[model samples]
Target: MGHDTVETPNLSFGRGATPDRSTPYARYVRLDELHSLQHPRSKEPAELSFIVTTQVMELLFDLLRHEWTIARQALREDDLPAALAALRRGTHAQDVLVDSWDLLATMTPQEFNSFRSLFGEASGFQSAAFLHLEFLLGNKNAALLAMYDGMPGTQAGLTEALRAPSLYDEALALLARRGLLPPQEASEQRYRPSEEVAAAWRRVYTEPESATLRPLGEALLDVAERVTRWRQRHLSAVKRTMGGKPGSGGSSGLTWLRKSAEQDVFPELWTIRDGL
Candidate 1:
């Protein structure tokens, strides 16, 4: 019996075989729609980078929101490990969001001014994703919801988030279920720090082995710190590019950003650290 040698198939990607555009990667990612979103309103070459970078940040905001939602749901189900995993992922996404500022950090006032006027009344303040992210982080503000009044869908989405339990609320509820403290009241109103919540965080920090919430507390702090860092970088970027001028959306630009940066996400987490 004679044996014939068989040639193996050439599966070398991006070379021997033409790339399949119909693959799941292209379909799932929708690269065509994603790439098509960068529409610059100005002829300036830098405008393209600005538009793309802003779009990237918006996508990141949505990603972070999704992660927070997952974390909250996990907490609600008393799945501490899953909640921590989701929160850790969110922190990583936040770092990427912070670093994304580098893409626009070097823009001079003149460079931004070249196309700034073209976006009249359009500003980051009007970003629905960012607003939703803030709401999920427990920074609910009904006044901010007014900004989306004309857009029924976006406004309705924001209102829903506003009325839902925030990430911190879920964390507190989980801790309460574990007998760490009393259960937190789920409210759609703005978040106000409670002495009891602060004390619970202190207990978590002070007791390592006994406190089941220690790691969760740390994960929450990581998210809070990352958000603070992002706001700081955003403020710096805005200051460098626009100085103290009024924002495109009628905001007081640098002043508004500075004030917004002062807001501490998970305030109880930080206050607890000081006492620890």
Candidate 2:
């Protein structure tokens, strides 16, 4: 008797049936989920644009936080090359974030008024991610974390980030480790804008080939500049949109943002720029 023959269907495993390549014909990125997120409370066309722009900014904020974390870790390890790479990525991410404000800048007072009431008490002032980014950049304030008390997860995350060493702190510590800065214990009193640190950075800037340290100094300056640009753009957006109105979080809107923006990300970096 002849034995029966059987065959099983071939199934390609790993990365799914779709090949890991893209062309003009086919693309992947889960657009369905991304496009579905824009649910405007109002039927007005401008509402969709506003919602999308804010959502895009939130996404960019998340990216910036990721890059900042990487940069902070690299700085902690005294790995200038890795730190510079992460800082460059962060600067590019910030550029995208700054440009996002342009999208909302076009909203006139009339267009914003239509949906402004719909957003009652809901403003970027309550944005936990934004606050977390500030905390990571050494802009911590206990009051900012209070806004998240009702939300346990947000409060917890912000509190943890607040206690962690900021990006600038890591950079300063790196300087101290490399002997370019004064002793950490002595400098602990005023970690920011230290006269010693500023002088050290000035040396780095003036003497371009100071043992491969100039690149690290320049990279940090780039990060600081990008952060300042983001803050300025944010202030401009607030002024254009709400004028002098109180923020949804109960602060003086534009005025509060202006003060917040005035606080530098890397104080010594800018201080040294003037001397150089």
- Quantify all predictions' global Cα lDDT against the true fold: 0.87, 0.79
Lowest summed lDDT across 10 adjacent residues in model 2 is found at 183-192
Best by lDDT: 1
State residue 156's C-alpha deviation in candidate 2, in Å: 1.6
- The top-ranked prediction according to TM-score is 1
| Number of clashes recorded per candidate | 0, 0
Q: What's the lDDT for candidate 1?
A: 0.87
TM-score of 2: 0.84
lDDT of 1 by residue, 42-81 (tens): 8888888899888889989999989999999999998999
Compose the digit string of candidate 2's lDDT tens values, residues 65-122.
9988998999888778888998898888888888888888888877888888897888
Stretches of candidate 2 exceeding 4 Å from the true structure: 1-28, 185-191, 207-211
